[model samples]
Every structure is written in structure tokens, then in C-alpha cells.
Target chain A: MMTSTDAGLPALIARMTGDEKHAAASESTLDVLWVLYDRVLDVTPDTVHDPRRDRFLLSKGHGPMAYYAVLAAKGFIAPEELDDWASVRSRLGQHPDRNRVPGVEISSGSLGHGLPLAVGTVYGLRAQGIGSKVFVLVGDAELDEGSNHEAIVLAARESMGQLTAVVIDNRSATRGWPGGIAQRFAIEGWATATVDGRDHEALYEAFTTPHPRRPLCVVAVVEPKSGQR
Target chain B: MDMRTTFLSTMEEALAVDPRLVLVLADISAGTGPVLAAQRRHPDRVLNVGIREQALIGVTGGLALTGMRPVAHTFPPFLVERPYEQIKLDLCHQGVGAVLVSSGASYDMAAAGRTHHSAADVALLDTVPGWTVHVPGHPEEARRLLLESLPGDGRVYLRLSSQANARAHLGAGFLTLRQGTRGVVLAVGPMLDRVLAATEGLDVTVLYAATIRPFDAAGLRAALGEVADVMLVEPYQAGTSAHHVGEALADVPHRLRSLGTQRDVEVRQYGEVTDHDFVHGLDVAGITAAARAFFR
Candidate 1:
């Protein structure tokens, strides 16, 4: 039953089943996570604790199957470990706990925490004069939490140049963002790009594009959550 | 200098020497001389996130994760309660630590009304694990506690108050200021001055505690000896530490009476701190009346 797209990443994701309450949430970020781990992030399993290594913070921590799959694919965790996810012995819980999981930056399940944490991560890195870029992945619906706005506005205003926020927009937020998700960040002065979420090359370009002296917001627009399997 | 001023100066000195120390503010004390100077001197380290408390805490967590020691400051309500989830998930759950220095403890900004009051801060933090709560009674104690917390990567909440004790009792454990045979009276932070004033002629042991968490059970037990009559005069919500007292005296037949800010009803009035103190039964006269009745 596997499609051509399901050969590599989706096959890995299929290993962790029976806890698909946020299947849409996880599916929406699969391409973005793969692109980041595989192509963009300058982090490896060996450099998880390296002070000079770039940090990838998963702010959208719900339905983290896609994230775990990506991490496993990139050799951060064993692919077999994904099978027992949410089980008693599994470090991969329903939500990611950074303490228990390697290569995971912040322990998050609560929405709106990741962006602020990511903003802080950049500031912290900047304070030490370590020029490590911090990337945070948040869901569009997650932005509804006012805490994210606090971070969104502050990050841009403070000119957190080293921070990049990838907001996965699947049109799931109850009161949908009025001018689209990218506009939200753009209005706050963050350098933004609205790329097709499933387009790998577009995502790569959006992420790699230079947006100096300000934080970057890459809105990967995916299929509406309701339209997904 | 007051505890608040001492906190700023101590933080400034720490920032000057320790590059790893980062101060994140939600525009609380962003304009103060020490803070402004520190920001000017070390722009990268001192961050004013512009009235965003949740972001302030989240930023602190981020800093700690990256091996920087972060000190986040604001009022209790804004700093603690407002961004509670951030404190829980971002810092504690993330397995990193930060020094959360909060001023305007309880009703310090009495004229600001209940919107600014945060009597439930310590009690709220009690719900989370691995937090070191320090309610310093004097400026010196606040300075010492802040200095002690900066170097270590641990969860610490240094609560500073406008109301202060005449003298600072510097110790991590409950220091027995006066020994008596009747019962043990434990006074936390600013409550010490009033507790002492209230128990001047009474034959009750007066113990001062700047550090409330890790509750200092052994010190409380040692102060009590065999007699189990204990009274806790705290500055935060009343009975906030009653559970801790119960746990400490689980095996002993101890009688406990707790005195602190009222829990059942909000004062609903903006007045002087003295008025709020009297209303909460935290003033000298209120403490004397409560102590005499309970001890008798």
C-alpha cells in the first residue's frame, strides 16, 4: 500500500503507529523535518552536545512521529526505537522530552513554547559569541496561543538574526490567521517565505535564502489537515 | 539599598565578570540604572524582551539549554504565574535551569490592586519539581542568595520584597534567633520582623528562614525538640507550606497554626501595604493576637 513518496520517510513513520491522534499535525511537518535534518541543519548525532553546532528545536511537539522518523533517519536514534514509541520503555513519548531524547533541543508539547524557546536559544548562543543558527518548527494552529505572538514580535524586534522559525500551516487553527501565517511574521519584521510544504526544493531554497539582520520565518504551506489521510 | 536594588547591583557585577550569565527582562526593570548600565556594558547578555513575560521565561530556558546561566526578572504575577507553563516545560521539563528573580512579592505593589498581587507564586512553584525558592528577608540575604545561585545551573526563584526585616539572618537553614520553651515560631523572610515584634515577650522559639524550599525539616525538628507546637508565619498564601509541615511532622504529634496572606478571599481593594498586611493577619498586632490564642 506504499506510494512512491512513502518509500523512505513515510515508511519509517509507519513503524510508529496506534497513536495517530495528531496524524495531520505530524504529516504536515514530515517534508519540512526531512528537509531540515537531511539537507539544512548543520547538526549530526556526534555534535548533539557540541557548543558550536546548530540547534533544531521542535516547537510543534504534538504528533511527533514525523520528527522521530526524521531524527532516526539522520542516525540520531535507532529506527527500531520508533516501533515502541509511547510504550513504557520508549524514550520517544507522545510528546518529545529533550532530556530523554537525543538531538531534541527543547522538551515541548505545550503549544507556543518552541518559538520563544528558540528565540532564547539564539540569544543565549549570541551571548556566548557562538554563531550557531537555531531553527524552530511550529504549527500554524500553535500560533493561536498568545505566547507565540510574544515571541514572534520580540524575536523580530530584537533582530535575532540567527533564529529561523518554520511554521507548518495546514489551516488547522480555529480562528484562522487573517492574512496567512507568513504575513504574521512579515508584519513583525521577520524575513518570511511561504513555500509549498511538500515541495522539497522550494523548502530548501526558502530555508537557505539569506535574510540577514532579522529572524527568518519560513511558512511551509501544506494540504489542509482535513484533506489529509 | 533595598533588596531590589541589591539584586540589580549584584546582577550587574555578576554580568560584568561572568560572561555566561544572561539577564532576561520583560521590561520590568529595563530602565533602572544598574539594568540599563549592564545592558549598555554587555548588550548581548542583558535582554529586555518588552513586557513579554512568557517570552522572557522561554528565552531564559533557551539560554540555559545553550550553557548560559540566565536570570529572568519581573514582578511575581507577571514572572511566575503569567508564564507558568513556560517555567514548567521550557525550563524544568527541558532539564535546564535559570534564576527567576521576582520583585513585588505578594502585595508589595499594594496600590496596584489584585492584578499585580502574586501571593500564590511560591505555592504555584511548589507544584513543579527541583525549584530552590529563596524568600530573602533582607538585602544582604538577597545578594548572597543571588550570588550563590548564579554559578550553578539549577532552578532557583529568588523572591525580593519591598518589606524587609531590620536585620538579616544569613543562613540556608532555619536559624534559631531566639530559644524558648513554649513552642517554635518559624518566620519566613519579611515576616521575621513582625513575628519578632509580635513574640517579643512570649516564651516561644523564633526561627528565621530565608530559604523556604527543601523546607529545612531537620532545623524545624531540632528547634521543636520534643514539644510539637509549631507556627509558620509566611509572607505568601497561608497554608502554602502546611503540607510540607504535615509531611515533616508525619510521625510526631505536632500542632500547627499557619499565618500568611489570605487565601479564601481577595482583598479587592488597593491601599497601602500596611492595610493589606493587617487585613491578611500579617501585621504585628494580628500576629500577636493569633500567636497568644494558639499558644495558650
Candidate 2:
């Protein structure tokens, strides 16, 4: 029900209240999601189930109001469903379910699942001789999950050129990375980029740039964590 | 050949036949494993995710979603317990199926201590619905089960232990090794030999089962004719099959007892798997006593 003509992140989120919403999780990945749906990703409402359409997986699924907002703005889902998210009758839960949601690729409430799922998807797509690309979004804090490191290393070794891992950094990783977040991925032979999360044009450029014969990892540096920012 | 070797060779066959076959490992190497060679042959399909178990399972989900049949392999606890949530959400909850092949069942790696022992692996898997569990007693059975998982989209948990039965069961389901009139003893996986040894003189029929999930309720009911006593001895956990047995015999009044590994108390004492088996009342002497008492 929500169309781009009258919908914004604020209006969509305002519909779902007192439903255990994750404001910070959605806010941190908001700009990244917007940039991907609006300009970077080739998937539209029509091509959601098409094999040639680009695939976007939300690994950072704690706060999905922002994701729902973007999907609604792009006409992937009805705007009216936003008001009853996480309800007993609603298809949406605290975590997004791929079976219930229209555009969700993988169900994620648990951290460290998205990157590996994306790598697997890329490998699967290639096996079927399909060339569509996969993009997965995760939180900086979520990197602490050792699973993401496994995916990072393996994807690079396989030269997963069609896969892209986007880390939305809010300075939340416990015992943070040494040189920088992108450096960790770079050590694993990934083509890396570091950009400001809020800058729309920078985010779009980083996503669109080509990296031959290697998986792409983009570190989107957002504002400081909650309470500090 | 051992179950490990059979599993690898069978997987190689699966890969040769189906282009969709993808093998995922977690830093586990079995004598220059076949998958490693396949990795060189097809660099994209054979993936070693290091020792990360969560991603090992999660990646299988992604591969399955992309219409690939994935086989994720690792130690039991590392494969099942650590990334259980990943299996639940990414694979099961998503209604996608992947073959999870695990090594070191219970104290299979007894020398490796508690970290390697997965006595509760099957029971933990039992908590989740819709998984076909195969505790293969022999390499032949493991080979058959692994080959069977390829063509379908059903989820399967293939448990291969270091301890194997003396003979390969070239077939599946409950094979009637001995006939008796007093009671029926169901032996699961490696427990078959020990059960046969325990009931050497008892007037009880023994049935061996490697595929324990599809329970064979019809076979059990048919085997239960004129017998009201049934004892289930699993190599993994005790009382895991008590409910299944009870459900099968609900209409007919009968006595059902389950005997296997004990999970109630922590057995900090570590030695040979035989010691753990003795502690869990799965030894020959222990199973003999439980069988006699149940039939009495």
C-alpha cells in the first residue's frame, strides 16, 4: 500500500509501534539498503523471483523496519502490512522469514549467517551456469561471528567474482579489527573499498565498480554507535 | 573399507553423476580426501570453510537455495551443536534440504576427550522435526544412504562413527538376526553386536536398524505380534526412542523400554569408549540386565 510518492523511512517505520522494533539495527543499515534498492541493485518488484535479477540478502536482520521500508518504497511489499509486523497474524517476525516475506532471500535473526549464505548462493548460481550477482549486508559487530571469516576466506579462494559482501560499520565489533575492517577482507584476497555510509553517491560508486576474478567487499563506515552518536 | 572411506568414495560417485553436488568441509582431512581432489577438478564446488562450523552449515543452505544439493561435513559436535541455529533457520526453517555428514559419534574419538564425544547428537537433532537420521552400522549401509540422499530434496543427518559393526549390512531396516518368542530387542547401529552378545541365551528376538528416523512402525508392529515386550538399544542416547515406541504400540497394551547412552549426569572420567559405554549401561553386562528386567 505504501508507494514512493508518499513514503519515506520515517512514515513506514511510524506504522509499526510497540512491536519490539530494532531502531538501531535498521538505522545503521538504512542508507546502505536505500542506496542498493534505489540505484545499485538491478532487482525491481517485477523481477523479484527472476533468476537474472540481482539478489540481496539481509544478514543484519535484528531491525528490519528499515528493510521493510525500502522494500515498500520499491513496491516489493504492501505498505499496510508494516503496521502489524511481528504480530501473531503478521507474516513478519522479529527476524525476516524468506518463506513469508516477498523479497527476503534468507531468514536471519541470528548473526553470522548472511555472508556464508551469500557465498553458497553464488556458488550455487555458478553451478547452474547462471551469472546473476549476489549482495549481502552485515553489521561490523556481526563480524565477530567466526562464520563470516570462513566465508570471507573461502569466497576469495574460489574467486567468487559475482559475490559482494557489504559491511555496515558502526564501531560495534568486539575487540575490533587491527588496521581497519576492509583490511581484514583484503588479507583474504578480496577486492576491497572503504566508503562513508551516509554518502549516497559514494555508496553507489563503490557498489557499481567492477573487480575482476575476485569477490568484492565494501566497508561502509556509518556514524558512531548509539548513545555516542 | 571403513565408513569414512566409503562415504568419501560414495560422495565422489555422487559428484560424478550430479553436477549439482557441492562438498563443504570444516578443516577435516581424511588421507587427502576425495573432495580435495575434486576441488582441483572443479574449484568452485568443493569448498573447505576451515574450522568454522556455522558458515559450513549456512553455506549449505545458500547452495541448496540456489538449486544445488550440498553435503556439509565435519565432527559431530562441531557440525551439529555449534551451528544448530544456522541449520534450524537457514536450512530447515527455509524448507531447504542438505546432507549433513558427521564423523565421531558419541566417544568415537574417545581419546580426544569430552570435546569430541557427541553422545547427545541424535537427541539434539531429535529436537528439530523432519530430519531423516541414519546411524549406519556398516560402511555398505553408509554408502547406500549417502547415494540415496542425492536425487531428493529431503534433509538427512548421516552419522558415521569410528566404531563399526564387524560385517557390512548390504541392506537397511530391521534385519531379524535371531528369532524368539518372549520379547523383541531393537538394536540401533553399533549396538547390534553388543545386543547379540548380551542376549546370547535369552529367549528374545533381535532386530538391527541403521536407519532410525522413518522408525519402521509397520515393521515394529508386525514384529511385535504375540510379543508385548520391546527394548530399544541405541548407541547415542537412552530414552530417545521411548516416545516413538510408545506411539507405535499405543493401541496394543505393551511394555516398552529404551536403553543407550546416559545423559543425566556428567561422566568426567575419560578412557576408552568401552569405559564410557560401561558407564552409560550400554555394555554387554548392563544391556543384559536391562533386557532381563524389562522382559520380567
Candidate 1 stretches greater than 4 Å from native: A1-7, A18-22, A227-229
Models, CA RMSD each = 2.3, 3.1
- Model 1 TM-score is 0.96
TM-score of 2: 0.91
User: Lowest summed-lDDT stretch of 10 residues in model 1 chain A?
Assistant: A1-10
**Could you tell me how far off, in angstroms, the CA of residue B110 lies in candidate 1 after the best superposition?**
1.3
Tens digits of per-residue lDDT, candidate 1, A1-229, equal: 2222543777788889754444777888888888887778899999998999989988888989889988888889999998889999999999999889989888888888988888888888887788888899988888899989998888888888888999898888889988788887898899999999988889989999888889999999999888533
The Cα local distance difference test for each model comes to 0.89, 0.85
What TM-score fits each model? 0.96, 0.91
Report the error of model 1 at residue B218, Å. Answer: 0.5
Candidate 1 residue lDDT tens string, B1-296: 99999999999999999989999888888899999999899999989898888889988988888899999999999999988888888888999899999999999999999999999999999999999999999999999999999998999999999999888788669999999988899999999989989999888899999999979989988888547899999999999889998998899998999999988996898899999998999999999999999887
Candidate whose lDDT is highest: 1
Q: List the residue pairs that clash in candidate 1.
A: none
Error in Å for residue A224 of model 1: 1.0
Candidate 2 local Cα displacement, residue B184, angstroms:
2.0
